[model samples]
Target: MAQNLMVCQFCETSNETKYKCANCDLILCEGCKIKIHTKIKKTEVHQVLDLKEFSNLSASETIRHLDLKDIQCSIHNAEHCIIYCEDCKLLLCAVCLLESHRTHNLTKIDEMYHRKVKELQELDSKLCEELPFYADLEKELKQIKSESEIKEIITKQRENIITELDRLWVPREEEISRQLKDTAEYCDALKRNKAQNEETFQSHNATAIFTASGKLDKDLPTRPANTISKQKILFSETRIPEDTKEVFGSVLTDPKCKITGSFTLNTEDSIYKIKTFENNTNILSLTKKSTIKSFELKHSKCNTTSI
Candidate 1:
Protein backbone atom coordinates (compact mmCIF):
# COMPACT_ATOMS: atom_id res chain seq x y z
CA MET A 1 0.00 0.00 0.00
CA ALA A 2 1.26 3.61 -0.85
CA GLN A 3 1.10 5.88 2.34
CA ASN A 4 1.08 9.77 2.28
CA LEU A 5 4.39 11.46 3.17
CA MET A 6 5.61 15.11 3.77
CA VAL A 7 8.95 16.94 3.77
CA CYS A 8 10.45 18.19 7.08
CA GLN A 9 10.94 22.00 7.04
CA PHE A 10 14.21 22.14 8.96
CA CYS A 11 16.23 19.06 7.81
CA GLU A 12 14.63 18.66 4.31
CA THR A 13 14.03 14.99 5.16
CA SER A 14 10.98 12.98 4.00
CA ASN A 15 8.78 12.07 7.01
CA GLU A 16 5.19 12.34 8.17
CA THR A 17 4.32 16.01 9.15
CA LYS A 18 3.71 15.99 12.91
CA TYR A 19 3.44 19.72 13.90
CA LYS A 20 3.30 23.27 12.45
CA CYS A 21 5.25 26.37 13.59
CA ALA A 22 2.78 29.19 14.26
CA ASN A 23 5.22 32.07 13.67
CA CYS A 24 6.98 30.71 10.57
CA ASP A 25 3.98 28.63 9.30
CA LEU A 26 6.27 25.67 8.50
CA ILE A 27 5.45 21.94 8.62
CA LEU A 28 8.01 19.76 10.40
CA CYS A 29 8.58 16.03 11.11
CA GLU A 30 8.73 14.81 14.74
CA GLY A 31 12.54 14.61 14.98
CA CYS A 32 13.22 17.89 13.09
CA LYS A 33 10.53 19.75 15.08
CA ILE A 34 12.04 18.74 18.47
CA LYS A 35 15.57 19.64 17.30
CA ILE A 36 14.52 23.04 15.78
CA HIS A 37 12.58 24.00 18.92
CA THR A 38 15.36 23.04 21.39
CA LYS A 39 18.74 23.34 19.56
CA ILE A 40 18.60 27.06 18.82
CA LYS A 41 17.57 30.04 20.99
CA LYS A 42 16.06 31.83 17.94
CA THR A 43 13.50 29.02 17.31
CA GLU A 44 12.85 28.37 20.99
CA VAL A 45 10.11 31.07 21.26
CA HIS A 46 8.24 29.94 18.08
CA GLN A 47 4.81 28.49 18.79
CA VAL A 48 4.28 24.83 17.72
CA LEU A 49 0.72 23.59 17.24
CA ASP A 50 -0.71 20.21 16.39
CA LEU A 51 -1.42 19.66 12.69
CA LYS A 52 -5.18 19.35 13.20
CA GLU A 53 -5.37 22.42 15.52
CA PHE A 54 -3.52 24.73 13.06
CA SER A 55 -5.83 26.72 10.72
CA ASN A 56 -6.08 30.15 9.04
CA LEU A 57 -7.61 32.98 11.06
CA SER A 58 -11.30 33.95 10.46
CA ALA A 59 -12.26 37.20 8.58
CA SER A 60 -13.64 38.80 11.76
CA GLU A 61 -10.36 38.10 13.65
CA THR A 62 -8.12 39.70 10.96
CA ILE A 63 -8.34 43.18 12.55
CA ARG A 64 -5.89 43.78 15.41
CA HIS A 65 -6.99 44.70 19.00
CA LEU A 66 -5.18 48.03 19.69
CA ASP A 67 -6.93 49.32 22.91
CA LEU A 68 -7.42 52.78 21.26
CA LYS A 69 -9.37 54.23 24.20
CA ASP A 70 -7.74 57.30 25.89
CA ILE A 71 -6.96 56.22 29.46
CA GLN A 72 -6.06 59.79 30.61
CA CYS A 73 -9.78 60.45 31.11
CA SER A 74 -9.84 57.63 33.65
CA ILE A 75 -8.60 60.13 36.27
CA HIS A 76 -11.88 62.07 35.93
CA ASN A 77 -13.91 58.86 36.05
CA ALA A 78 -14.92 59.53 32.44
CA GLU A 79 -14.58 56.69 29.93
CA HIS A 80 -12.83 56.88 26.56
CA CYS A 81 -11.75 60.57 25.81
CA ILE A 82 -11.31 60.72 22.02
CA ILE A 83 -12.43 64.31 21.27
CA TYR A 84 -10.18 67.42 21.55
CA CYS A 85 -11.67 70.73 22.79
CA GLU A 86 -10.25 73.50 20.60
CA ASP A 87 -11.23 76.46 22.79
CA CYS A 88 -10.36 74.88 26.15
CA LYS A 89 -7.33 72.93 24.82
CA LEU A 90 -8.03 69.62 26.57
CA LEU A 91 -8.58 65.95 25.89
CA LEU A 92 -12.03 64.78 26.98
CA CYS A 93 -14.00 61.50 26.91
CA ALA A 94 -17.75 61.26 26.03
CA VAL A 95 -19.10 61.91 29.57
CA CYS A 96 -16.61 64.62 30.74
CA LEU A 97 -16.65 66.26 27.28
CA LEU A 98 -20.46 66.62 27.28
CA GLU A 99 -20.55 67.85 30.93
CA SER A 100 -17.66 70.36 30.90
CA HIS A 101 -16.41 71.21 27.37
CA ARG A 102 -19.65 70.88 25.38
CA THR A 103 -20.07 74.62 24.88
CA HIS A 104 -16.38 75.08 23.84
CA ASN A 105 -15.15 74.79 20.25
CA LEU A 106 -14.41 71.17 19.46
CA THR A 107 -12.34 69.18 16.96
CA LYS A 108 -11.50 65.52 16.66
CA ILE A 109 -8.13 64.33 18.01
CA ASP A 110 -7.08 63.07 14.57
CA GLU A 111 -7.68 66.46 12.93
CA MET A 112 -5.94 68.42 15.72
CA TYR A 113 -2.87 66.17 15.62
CA HIS A 114 -2.45 66.53 11.84
CA ARG A 115 -2.95 70.33 11.69
CA LYS A 116 -1.09 71.48 14.84
CA VAL A 117 1.89 69.18 14.40
CA LYS A 118 2.45 70.31 10.78
CA GLU A 119 2.31 74.00 11.77
CA LEU A 120 4.69 73.51 14.71
CA GLN A 121 7.18 71.62 12.53
CA GLU A 122 7.15 74.38 9.89
CA LEU A 123 7.81 77.11 12.49
CA ASP A 124 10.66 75.06 13.97
CA SER A 125 12.28 74.66 10.53
CA LYS A 126 12.08 78.42 9.80
CA LEU A 127 13.74 79.32 13.09
CA CYS A 128 16.46 76.75 12.43
CA GLU A 129 17.20 78.33 9.02
CA GLU A 130 17.35 81.91 10.47
CA LEU A 131 19.59 81.05 13.44
CA PRO A 132 22.88 81.69 11.59
CA PHE A 133 21.94 85.26 10.61
CA TYR A 134 21.02 86.13 14.19
CA ALA A 135 24.29 84.65 15.42
CA ASP A 136 26.27 86.74 12.87
CA LEU A 137 24.46 89.95 13.93
CA GLU A 138 25.37 89.28 17.57
CA LYS A 139 29.02 88.72 16.61
CA GLU A 140 29.07 92.00 14.62
CA LEU A 141 27.62 93.94 17.58
CA LYS A 142 30.32 92.58 19.88
CA GLN A 143 33.04 93.64 17.41
CA ILE A 144 31.55 97.18 17.22
CA LYS A 145 31.54 97.44 21.01
CA SER A 146 35.23 96.44 21.15
CA GLU A 147 36.17 99.00 18.50
CA SER A 148 34.17 101.78 20.20
CA GLU A 149 35.97 101.16 23.52
CA ILE A 150 39.36 101.64 21.80
CA LYS A 151 38.10 104.85 20.11
CA GLU A 152 36.85 106.20 23.45
CA ILE A 153 40.31 105.82 24.97
CA ILE A 154 41.94 107.65 22.06
CA THR A 155 39.35 110.46 22.33
CA LYS A 156 40.21 110.99 26.01
CA GLN A 157 43.95 111.22 25.18
CA ARG A 158 43.26 113.74 22.41
CA GLU A 159 41.27 115.84 24.91
CA ASN A 160 44.30 115.88 27.22
CA ILE A 161 46.57 116.99 24.38
CA ILE A 162 44.15 119.80 23.51
CA THR A 163 44.14 120.91 27.18
CA GLU A 164 47.96 121.13 27.14
CA LEU A 165 47.90 123.21 23.94
CA ASP A 166 45.25 125.51 25.52
CA ARG A 167 47.76 126.60 28.22
CA LEU A 168 49.56 128.84 25.67
CA TRP A 169 46.53 131.17 25.46
CA VAL A 170 46.27 131.68 29.26
CA PRO A 171 49.21 134.15 29.59
CA ARG A 172 48.23 136.00 26.42
CA GLU A 173 44.71 136.56 27.80
CA GLU A 174 46.07 137.69 31.23
CA GLU A 175 48.40 140.29 29.62
CA ILE A 176 45.52 141.75 27.58
CA SER A 177 43.25 141.93 30.64
CA ARG A 178 45.90 143.75 32.72
CA GLN A 179 46.71 146.28 29.97
CA LEU A 180 42.99 147.22 29.61
CA LYS A 181 42.04 147.60 33.33
CA ASP A 182 43.17 151.26 33.76
CA THR A 183 41.61 152.31 30.44
CA ALA A 184 38.30 150.75 31.41
CA GLU A 185 38.36 152.55 34.83
CA TYR A 186 39.17 155.89 33.19
CA CYS A 187 36.23 155.54 30.78
CA ASP A 188 33.86 154.98 33.71
CA ALA A 189 35.20 158.15 35.45
CA LEU A 190 34.74 160.21 32.26
CA LYS A 191 31.07 159.18 32.02
CA ARG A 192 30.54 160.31 35.67
CA ASN A 193 32.19 163.70 34.92
CA LYS A 194 29.89 164.27 31.93
CA ALA A 195 26.85 163.63 34.15
CA GLN A 196 28.17 166.14 36.74
CA ASN A 197 28.75 168.80 34.04
CA GLU A 198 25.17 168.39 32.82
CA GLU A 199 23.88 168.82 36.40
CA THR A 200 26.01 171.96 36.87
CA PHE A 201 24.70 173.47 33.62
CA GLN A 202 21.13 173.18 34.90
CA SER A 203 21.89 174.69 38.35
CA HIS A 204 20.38 177.98 39.67
CA ASN A 205 23.79 179.80 39.77
CA ALA A 206 24.28 180.88 36.09
CA THR A 207 27.99 181.99 36.29
CA ALA A 208 29.24 178.86 38.13
CA ILE A 209 27.29 176.56 35.69
CA PHE A 210 28.78 178.37 32.64
CA THR A 211 32.36 178.01 34.07
CA ALA A 212 31.89 174.23 34.71
CA SER A 213 30.42 173.71 31.18
CA GLY A 214 33.51 175.33 29.61
CA LYS A 215 35.84 173.09 31.77
CA LEU A 216 34.28 169.82 30.46
CA ASP A 217 37.31 168.05 28.84
CA LYS A 218 37.35 165.03 26.44
CA ASP A 219 40.37 162.74 25.88
CA LEU A 220 40.71 159.69 23.55
CA PRO A 221 42.51 156.52 24.50
CA THR A 222 46.22 156.51 23.52
CA ARG A 223 46.12 152.88 22.31
CA PRO A 224 43.23 150.44 21.79
CA ALA A 225 43.09 147.73 24.51
CA ASN A 226 41.71 145.13 22.07
CA THR A 227 44.97 145.04 20.06
CA ILE A 228 45.85 141.33 20.48
CA SER A 229 47.46 140.07 17.26
CA LYS A 230 45.50 137.72 15.02
CA GLN A 231 48.42 135.27 14.99
CA LYS A 232 48.35 135.08 18.81
CA ILE A 233 44.61 134.41 18.92
CA LEU A 234 44.54 131.87 16.09
CA PHE A 235 47.77 130.02 17.09
CA SER A 236 48.22 129.19 13.41
CA GLU A 237 51.83 130.45 13.12
CA THR A 238 53.00 128.66 16.32
CA ARG A 239 55.30 125.64 15.85
CA ILE A 240 54.57 122.78 18.24
CA PRO A 241 57.69 121.06 19.61
CA GLU A 242 56.10 117.58 19.25
CA ASP A 243 56.51 116.11 15.76
CA THR A 244 54.07 114.02 13.71
CA LYS A 245 55.93 110.82 14.67
CA GLU A 246 55.41 111.47 18.40
CA VAL A 247 51.78 112.41 17.84
CA PHE A 248 51.01 109.21 15.93
CA GLY A 249 53.02 106.97 18.28
CA SER A 250 51.78 108.27 21.68
CA VAL A 251 49.98 111.59 21.30
CA LEU A 252 46.63 110.33 20.00
CA THR A 253 46.69 106.59 20.72
CA ASP A 254 45.62 105.04 24.04
CA PRO A 255 47.67 102.27 25.71
CA LYS A 256 45.21 99.43 25.02
CA CYS A 257 44.76 99.95 21.26
CA LYS A 258 45.71 102.53 18.64
CA ILE A 259 42.93 104.58 16.98
CA THR A 260 42.96 107.07 14.13
CA GLY A 261 40.57 109.88 13.16
CA SER A 262 39.31 110.60 9.65
CA PHE A 263 41.56 112.72 7.38
CA THR A 264 44.29 112.81 10.02
CA LEU A 265 47.66 114.08 8.69
CA ASN A 266 50.17 111.38 9.69
CA THR A 267 53.37 112.96 8.24
CA GLU A 268 55.08 116.35 8.36
CA ASP A 269 54.97 118.55 5.23
CA SER A 270 56.10 122.11 4.54
CA ILE A 271 53.11 122.63 2.19
CA TYR A 272 49.44 122.91 3.05
CA LYS A 273 46.30 123.08 0.94
CA ILE A 274 44.05 126.11 1.49
CA LYS A 275 40.60 126.87 0.15
CA THR A 276 40.93 130.42 -1.22
CA PHE A 277 37.65 130.51 -3.19
CA GLU A 278 34.67 128.38 -4.01
CA ASN A 279 35.69 125.36 -6.11
CA ASN A 280 39.35 126.40 -5.72
CA THR A 281 41.85 124.68 -3.42
CA ASN A 282 45.30 126.25 -3.84
CA ILE A 283 48.68 124.99 -2.60
CA LEU A 284 50.14 127.69 -0.32
CA SER A 285 53.61 126.11 -0.04
CA LEU A 286 55.45 123.76 -2.43
CA THR A 287 58.21 122.12 -0.31
CA LYS A 288 58.39 118.82 1.57
CA LYS A 289 59.70 118.70 5.15
CA SER A 290 62.44 116.09 4.51
CA THR A 291 63.78 117.89 1.43
CA ILE A 292 63.01 121.61 1.80
CA LYS A 293 63.09 122.18 -1.98
CA SER A 294 60.28 123.66 -4.09
CA PHE A 295 58.91 121.82 -7.13
CA GLU A 296 61.03 122.39 -10.24
CA LEU A 297 59.23 125.25 -11.98
CA LYS A 298 57.16 124.31 -14.99
CA HIS A 299 58.06 126.28 -18.12
CA SER A 300 55.77 129.23 -18.87
CA LYS A 301 53.19 128.52 -21.58
CA CYS A 302 52.91 132.25 -22.54
CA ASN A 303 55.71 134.81 -23.17
CA THR A 304 54.70 137.07 -20.22
CA THR A 305 53.73 134.30 -17.78
CA SER A 306 55.66 133.38 -14.55
CA ILE A 307 55.84 129.90 -12.93
Candidate 2:
Protein backbone atom coordinates (compact mmCIF):
# COMPACT_ATOMS: atom_id res chain seq x y z
CA MET A 1 0.00 0.00 0.00
CA ALA A 2 1.07 3.60 -0.34
CA GLN A 3 0.97 3.83 3.45
CA ASN A 4 4.20 1.72 3.51
CA LEU A 5 5.72 3.99 0.82
CA MET A 6 7.89 7.02 1.64
CA VAL A 7 5.93 9.60 -0.44
CA CYS A 8 3.05 11.60 1.09
CA GLN A 9 -0.32 10.31 -0.04
CA PHE A 10 -2.13 13.69 0.06
CA CYS A 11 0.07 15.60 -2.42
CA GLU A 12 2.48 12.85 -3.67
CA THR A 13 4.89 15.67 -4.40
CA SER A 14 7.65 15.61 -1.76
CA ASN A 15 9.60 12.65 -0.34
CA GLU A 16 10.83 14.54 2.79
CA THR A 17 7.57 13.52 4.55
CA LYS A 18 8.06 13.37 8.33
CA TYR A 19 4.44 12.88 9.54
CA LYS A 20 1.35 10.71 8.81
CA CYS A 21 -2.15 10.00 10.19
CA ALA A 22 -2.63 6.53 11.70
CA ASN A 23 -6.45 6.74 12.27
CA CYS A 24 -7.24 7.80 8.71
CA ASP A 25 -6.29 5.91 5.52
CA LEU A 26 -4.19 8.91 4.36
CA ILE A 27 -0.58 10.16 4.59
CA LEU A 28 0.35 13.89 4.68
CA CYS A 29 3.32 16.12 3.99
CA GLU A 30 5.20 17.90 6.78
CA GLY A 31 3.62 21.33 6.09
CA CYS A 32 0.12 20.06 5.38
CA LYS A 33 -0.03 17.61 8.29
CA ILE A 34 1.30 20.17 10.75
CA LYS A 35 -1.12 22.84 9.61
CA ILE A 36 -4.24 20.58 9.33
CA HIS A 37 -3.60 17.97 12.04
CA THR A 38 -1.48 19.43 14.84
CA LYS A 39 -2.36 23.14 14.76
CA ILE A 40 -6.09 22.88 13.91
CA LYS A 41 -8.35 22.88 16.98
CA LYS A 42 -10.97 20.40 15.72
CA THR A 43 -8.50 17.69 14.54
CA GLU A 44 -5.78 18.51 17.08
CA VAL A 45 -6.90 15.70 19.36
CA HIS A 46 -7.28 13.22 16.44
CA GLN A 47 -4.54 10.57 17.32
CA VAL A 48 -2.05 11.18 14.51
CA LEU A 49 1.36 9.39 14.17
CA ASP A 50 4.54 10.24 12.27
CA LEU A 51 5.45 8.43 8.97
CA LYS A 52 8.55 6.89 10.67
CA GLU A 53 6.31 5.27 13.37
CA PHE A 54 3.87 4.18 10.74
CA SER A 55 6.62 2.46 8.82
CA ASN A 56 7.58 0.48 11.91
CA LEU A 57 4.02 -0.95 12.10
CA SER A 58 3.11 -4.09 10.10
CA ALA A 59 1.65 -3.10 6.72
CA SER A 60 0.54 -6.56 5.56
CA GLU A 61 1.25 -10.24 6.33
CA THR A 62 1.90 -11.71 2.79
CA ILE A 63 3.69 -8.66 1.33
CA ARG A 64 7.53 -9.12 1.13
CA HIS A 65 10.59 -7.50 -0.49
CA LEU A 66 14.25 -8.10 -1.32
CA ASP A 67 17.40 -5.93 -1.59
CA LEU A 68 17.57 -5.68 -5.42
CA LYS A 69 19.03 -2.22 -5.98
CA ASP A 70 22.23 -3.55 -7.59
CA ILE A 71 20.62 -6.40 -9.64
CA GLN A 72 19.73 -5.18 -13.13
CA CYS A 73 16.74 -6.77 -14.86
CA SER A 74 17.45 -8.78 -18.01
CA ILE A 75 14.00 -7.83 -19.34
CA HIS A 76 14.54 -4.11 -18.82
CA ASN A 77 18.10 -2.91 -18.28
CA ALA A 78 16.90 0.39 -16.81
CA GLU A 79 14.93 -1.40 -14.04
CA HIS A 80 16.15 -3.32 -10.98
CA CYS A 81 14.75 -6.67 -9.77
CA ILE A 82 12.56 -6.92 -6.70
CA ILE A 83 10.54 -10.13 -7.24
CA TYR A 84 11.25 -13.78 -8.22
CA CYS A 85 9.31 -16.06 -10.59
CA GLU A 86 8.65 -19.48 -9.01
CA ASP A 87 7.72 -21.20 -12.31
CA CYS A 88 10.61 -19.95 -14.49
CA LYS A 89 13.08 -19.61 -11.56
CA LEU A 90 14.23 -16.06 -12.38
CA LEU A 91 14.30 -12.63 -10.80
CA LEU A 92 11.79 -10.03 -12.04
CA CYS A 93 11.52 -6.23 -12.15
CA ALA A 94 8.48 -3.92 -11.88
CA VAL A 95 7.87 -4.10 -15.63
CA CYS A 96 8.09 -7.89 -15.47
CA LEU A 97 5.47 -7.81 -12.71
CA LEU A 98 2.87 -6.22 -15.09
CA GLU A 99 3.75 -7.91 -18.40
CA SER A 100 5.78 -11.14 -18.07
CA HIS A 101 4.71 -12.64 -14.72
CA ARG A 102 1.06 -11.42 -14.72
CA THR A 103 -0.26 -14.98 -14.54
CA HIS A 104 2.95 -16.73 -13.44
CA ASN A 105 3.43 -17.71 -9.83
CA LEU A 106 5.81 -15.09 -8.44
CA THR A 107 7.42 -15.16 -4.95
CA LYS A 108 9.55 -12.94 -2.76
CA ILE A 109 13.31 -13.60 -3.11
CA ASP A 110 13.68 -14.52 0.60
CA GLU A 111 10.93 -17.24 0.37
CA MET A 112 12.60 -18.66 -2.74
CA TYR A 113 15.93 -18.64 -0.89
CA HIS A 114 14.45 -20.78 1.89
CA ARG A 115 13.05 -23.20 -0.69
CA LYS A 116 16.45 -23.47 -2.43
CA VAL A 117 18.19 -24.09 0.92
CA LYS A 118 15.91 -27.14 1.42
CA GLU A 119 16.88 -28.55 -2.02
CA LEU A 120 20.61 -27.94 -1.27
CA GLN A 121 20.34 -29.86 2.01
CA GLU A 122 18.85 -32.84 0.17
CA LEU A 123 21.60 -32.72 -2.50
CA ASP A 124 24.32 -32.46 0.18
CA SER A 125 23.04 -35.63 1.88
CA LYS A 126 23.16 -37.51 -1.46
CA LEU A 127 26.70 -36.22 -2.12
CA CYS A 128 27.82 -37.25 1.36
CA GLU A 129 26.64 -40.81 0.68
CA GLU A 130 28.08 -41.10 -2.87
CA LEU A 131 31.53 -39.35 -2.54
CA PRO A 132 33.19 -41.99 -0.26
CA PHE A 133 32.61 -44.83 -2.74
CA TYR A 134 34.37 -42.87 -5.51
CA ALA A 135 37.19 -42.01 -3.11
CA ASP A 136 37.69 -45.69 -2.19
CA LEU A 137 37.72 -46.68 -5.86
CA GLU A 138 40.34 -44.05 -6.56
CA LYS A 139 42.47 -45.30 -3.67
CA GLU A 140 42.25 -48.89 -4.96
CA LEU A 141 43.35 -47.85 -8.45
CA LYS A 142 46.38 -45.97 -7.04
CA GLN A 143 47.40 -49.00 -4.92
CA ILE A 144 47.27 -51.30 -7.95
CA LYS A 145 49.45 -48.92 -9.97
CA SER A 146 51.99 -48.54 -7.16
CA GLU A 147 52.27 -52.31 -6.66
CA SER A 148 52.90 -52.85 -10.36
CA GLU A 149 55.68 -50.22 -10.59
CA ILE A 150 57.50 -50.99 -7.30
CA LYS A 151 60.29 -53.06 -8.91
CA GLU A 152 61.02 -50.48 -11.62
CA ILE A 153 61.04 -47.68 -9.03
CA ILE A 154 63.57 -49.45 -6.81
CA THR A 155 65.85 -50.33 -9.76
CA LYS A 156 65.87 -46.73 -11.03
CA GLN A 157 66.65 -45.38 -7.55
CA ARG A 158 69.55 -47.83 -7.11
CA GLU A 159 71.02 -46.90 -10.48
CA ASN A 160 70.80 -43.17 -9.69
CA ILE A 161 72.56 -43.55 -6.30
CA ILE A 162 75.37 -45.67 -7.75
CA THR A 163 75.92 -43.20 -10.59
CA GLU A 164 76.20 -40.33 -8.07
CA LEU A 165 78.70 -42.27 -5.93
CA ASP A 166 80.85 -43.10 -8.96
CA ARG A 167 80.82 -39.44 -10.00
CA LEU A 168 82.09 -38.41 -6.55
CA TRP A 169 84.86 -41.14 -6.47
CA VAL A 170 86.38 -40.37 -9.92
CA PRO A 171 88.89 -37.83 -8.57
CA ARG A 172 90.15 -40.20 -5.83
CA GLU A 173 90.71 -42.98 -8.35
CA GLU A 174 92.73 -40.62 -10.61
CA GLU A 175 94.92 -39.56 -7.69
CA ILE A 176 95.67 -43.19 -6.77
CA SER A 177 96.63 -44.05 -10.39
CA ARG A 178 98.97 -41.03 -10.63
CA GLN A 179 100.72 -41.93 -7.37
CA LEU A 180 101.14 -45.58 -8.46
CA LYS A 181 102.81 -44.49 -11.72
CA ASP A 182 105.15 -42.11 -9.92
CA THR A 183 106.21 -44.83 -7.37
CA ALA A 184 106.87 -47.37 -10.18
CA GLU A 185 109.05 -44.85 -12.03
CA TYR A 186 111.01 -43.96 -8.89
CA CYS A 187 111.71 -47.66 -8.09
CA ASP A 188 112.95 -48.22 -11.65
CA ALA A 189 115.42 -45.30 -11.30
CA LEU A 190 116.72 -46.67 -7.98
CA LYS A 191 117.28 -50.14 -9.53
CA ARG A 192 119.24 -48.63 -12.42
CA ASN A 193 121.46 -46.65 -10.00
CA LYS A 194 122.19 -49.78 -7.93
CA ALA A 195 123.07 -51.81 -11.07
CA GLN A 196 125.50 -49.09 -12.25
CA ASN A 197 127.20 -48.90 -8.81
CA GLU A 198 127.59 -52.72 -8.68
CA GLU A 199 129.17 -52.76 -12.17
CA THR A 200 131.75 -50.05 -11.24
CA PHE A 201 132.68 -51.84 -7.98
CA GLN A 202 133.16 -55.25 -9.71
CA SER A 203 135.24 -53.91 -12.64
CA HIS A 204 137.67 -51.89 -10.47
CA ASN A 205 138.71 -54.41 -7.82
CA ALA A 206 140.08 -53.45 -4.37
CA THR A 207 143.90 -53.42 -4.12
CA ALA A 208 144.27 -53.99 -0.32
CA ILE A 209 142.09 -56.85 1.03
CA PHE A 210 142.19 -58.14 4.61
CA THR A 211 140.99 -61.65 5.54
CA ALA A 212 139.74 -63.06 8.87
CA SER A 213 143.02 -65.08 9.27
CA GLY A 214 144.85 -61.74 9.73
CA LYS A 215 146.54 -62.29 6.34
CA LEU A 216 146.84 -59.57 3.70
CA ASP A 217 146.74 -60.20 -0.06
CA LYS A 218 150.02 -59.55 -2.00
CA ASP A 219 150.61 -59.69 -5.74
CA LEU A 220 153.83 -61.69 -5.68
CA PRO A 221 155.41 -59.57 -2.85
CA THR A 222 154.76 -56.28 -4.76
CA ARG A 223 151.59 -54.68 -3.30
CA PRO A 224 149.26 -52.54 -5.40
CA ALA A 225 148.43 -48.93 -4.35
CA ASN A 226 145.53 -48.68 -1.80
CA THR A 227 142.71 -46.25 -2.57
CA ILE A 228 139.08 -45.69 -1.54
CA SER A 229 137.44 -49.11 -2.18
CA LYS A 230 133.68 -48.85 -1.41
CA GLN A 231 131.08 -46.19 -1.98
CA LYS A 232 128.85 -45.52 1.12
CA ILE A 233 125.05 -45.42 0.97
CA LEU A 234 123.09 -43.95 3.92
CA PHE A 235 119.63 -45.27 4.91
CA SER A 236 117.78 -46.41 8.04
CA GLU A 237 118.55 -50.02 9.05
CA THR A 238 115.23 -51.84 9.69
CA ARG A 239 116.01 -55.61 9.45
CA ILE A 240 118.56 -55.42 12.27
CA PRO A 241 117.82 -52.32 14.31
CA GLU A 242 120.15 -53.13 17.27
CA ASP A 243 123.24 -51.34 15.78
CA THR A 244 125.44 -54.19 17.15
CA LYS A 245 126.37 -57.23 14.97
CA GLU A 246 126.93 -59.35 18.10
CA VAL A 247 123.11 -59.39 18.74
CA PHE A 248 122.64 -61.50 15.61
CA GLY A 249 125.98 -63.31 15.56
CA SER A 250 124.38 -66.62 14.62
CA VAL A 251 123.25 -65.11 11.26
CA LEU A 252 126.39 -63.05 10.60
CA THR A 253 128.86 -64.12 7.88
CA ASP A 254 132.12 -64.76 9.80
CA PRO A 255 134.70 -64.69 6.95
CA LYS A 256 132.90 -62.31 4.56
CA CYS A 257 135.09 -59.18 4.12
CA LYS A 258 136.64 -59.64 7.64
CA ILE A 259 136.80 -56.32 9.47
CA THR A 260 139.87 -56.42 11.83
CA GLY A 261 139.11 -52.91 13.16
CA SER A 262 137.29 -51.16 15.96
CA PHE A 263 134.02 -49.31 14.94
CA THR A 264 132.46 -46.57 17.07
CA LEU A 265 129.39 -44.28 16.66
CA ASN A 266 130.24 -40.58 16.77
CA THR A 267 126.86 -39.27 18.04
CA GLU A 268 127.92 -35.58 17.91
CA ASP A 269 128.32 -35.74 14.12
CA SER A 270 125.87 -38.67 13.47
CA ILE A 271 128.67 -40.65 11.74
CA TYR A 272 130.31 -44.05 12.26
CA LYS A 273 134.14 -43.87 12.25
CA ILE A 274 136.30 -47.00 11.89
CA LYS A 275 140.06 -47.37 12.78
CA THR A 276 142.21 -50.03 11.13
CA PHE A 277 145.68 -51.07 12.44
CA GLU A 278 148.23 -52.34 9.89
CA ASN A 279 149.59 -54.89 12.39
CA ASN A 280 147.74 -56.26 15.44
CA THR A 281 150.38 -54.97 17.91
CA ASN A 282 151.03 -51.59 16.16
CA ILE A 283 148.44 -49.10 17.45
CA LEU A 284 150.49 -46.19 16.09
CA SER A 285 150.16 -47.18 12.39
CA LEU A 286 146.33 -46.85 12.12
CA THR A 287 143.99 -45.78 9.30
CA LYS A 288 140.80 -43.89 10.24
CA LYS A 289 137.78 -43.08 8.04
CA SER A 290 134.29 -41.54 8.57
CA THR A 291 131.51 -43.55 6.85
CA ILE A 292 129.26 -40.59 5.92
CA LYS A 293 127.06 -40.64 2.74
CA SER A 294 124.42 -38.37 1.11
CA PHE A 295 121.23 -39.79 -0.41
CA GLU A 296 118.04 -38.45 -2.11
CA LEU A 297 114.74 -38.88 -0.25
CA LYS A 298 111.66 -39.89 -2.26
CA HIS A 299 109.15 -39.94 0.59
CA SER A 300 105.50 -39.22 -0.06
CA LYS A 301 102.35 -39.02 2.15
CA CYS A 302 100.70 -42.00 0.42
CA ASN A 303 102.73 -44.67 2.28
CA THR A 304 104.87 -45.22 5.42
CA THR A 305 108.66 -45.14 5.01
CA SER A 306 110.38 -48.56 5.24
CA ILE A 307 114.03 -49.58 5.07
- Give one digit per residue, the lDDT tens place, for model 2 in 1-307: 3554467776677676776554344667777786555665656534455655544412211111212233567779998777778787677889988886889988876566445434433433443444444344335434433332323323343454435434533453454444434444434443443343323222211110001011211111111133112222121223345765522111111122645454432222432432334552211111243333322222321111211
TM-scores of all candidate predictions against the true structure: 0.30, 0.26
Could you say which candidate leads in lDDT?
1
Model 1 residue 246 lDDT score: 34
lDDT of 1 by residue, 83-150 (tens): 77877666678887768787899887656544543443343344344444334434543343333333
Q: Please state the error at residue 121 of candidate 2 in Å.
A: 3.2
Give the number of the best model, judged by TM-score.
1
Residue pairs in collision within model 2:
none
